[model samples]
Target: MADFDKPSSTEEEYFAREDIEKKRKLALQQADQLAAKQREDLRQLHFMKCPKCGMDLHTLKKGHVELDTCFNCKGVWLDAGELEQVLAQGSENNGKVMGAILNLFKRS
Candidate 1:
């Protein structure tokens, strides 16, 4: 007769596979955490910094929009949808200027 208290070979194999699977899951979770940390670190390093000159950007108010200006390079940057807002508030001369600029990018 076999001893009932002893685990069979199949039971031991099952537990070993379960332990391996648990370790794999933990590794995946740690990788995700590490990736999120890296993205946040990069954002902190580049936030509100100029791309052209690597200088600090200043906010200048124009109508309802806030423009990002780099004093070191004399470069002006517009955020998302700011160009449309500027065109909306601008005069006929400004419209012509924007029209000419837009036309430069149009395909024949």
Candidate 2:
């Protein structure tokens, strides 16, 4: 049989080793969680296919929102309150016009 513990293994020494091991494990777990969150955020930012033209959809920044637009069909796709955020920015000369255009491409 092989002995794993050191020859001078005191109770305090064992507890100190356990504390270091626990801290290492917690750090690894927190790093993994952070990596997973970053991957999910990157996935959410990926471009999608245009429902109107089947072409690549591009993201356009409207205020704080990222709106998906199809350059091929000149169509825009809004997720939830993205349109409201865009309009609320008080953009001049093209915001209202773009909103009208987006409305024209709405499905049902």
Candidate 3:
């Protein structure tokens, strides 16, 4: 006569597999949370910092655009569409505004 109170081998295997799957899901969720936290930390560390010299950036307002200028590196950074706005405003006076701005640098 076999004992009916004991669990079968197949039932034990199913529970083991279920435990492993639950552990895997938990680890994946933890990894995703850690990755998100790392990204936010990096963003905070590099926010508004200059790419060239790793210095602070100042906002200079010109017309309708706010430019990010690094005084230490003397680098000016423009956000999306600001350059086009500037060029469009300048083009109202003459259509060759881009060419005129390009001509400011002497040919070497």
Worst 10 residues of 3 by lDDT: 97-106
What TM-score does candidate 2 reach? 0.40
Per-model C-alpha RMSD: 7.3, 7.4, 5.0
lDDT of 1: 0.79
Off by over 4 Å in 2: 1-47, 91-108
lDDT at residue 98 of model 1 (Cα atoms): 53
> Candidate 3 has which clashing residue pairs, if any?
none
Candidate 3 local lDDT, 1-108, one digit each (tens): 466988899999999999999999999999999999999999999999999999998887655657787877777777899898768856775646545544433355
lDDT of 1 by residue, 1-108 (tens): 477888999999999999999999999999999999999999999888899998988887766767787777766688999988778766646666556544534555
How much is 58 displaced in model 3, in angstroms?
1.3
Ranking by lDDT, best first?
1, 3, 2
List model 2 lDDT by residue over 1-108, tens digit each.
256554556877988999999999999999999999999887666548787777888887654778788878887788998767767754664577567556756766
Residue 69, candidate 3: C-alpha displacement in angstroms: 0.7
1 or 2: which has the higher TM-score? 1
- Report the C-alpha displacement of residue 18, candidate 1, in angstroms: 1.6
Native-to-model Cα distance after best TM-score fit, residue 18 in candidate 2, in Å:
44
TM-score, candidate 1, is 0.76
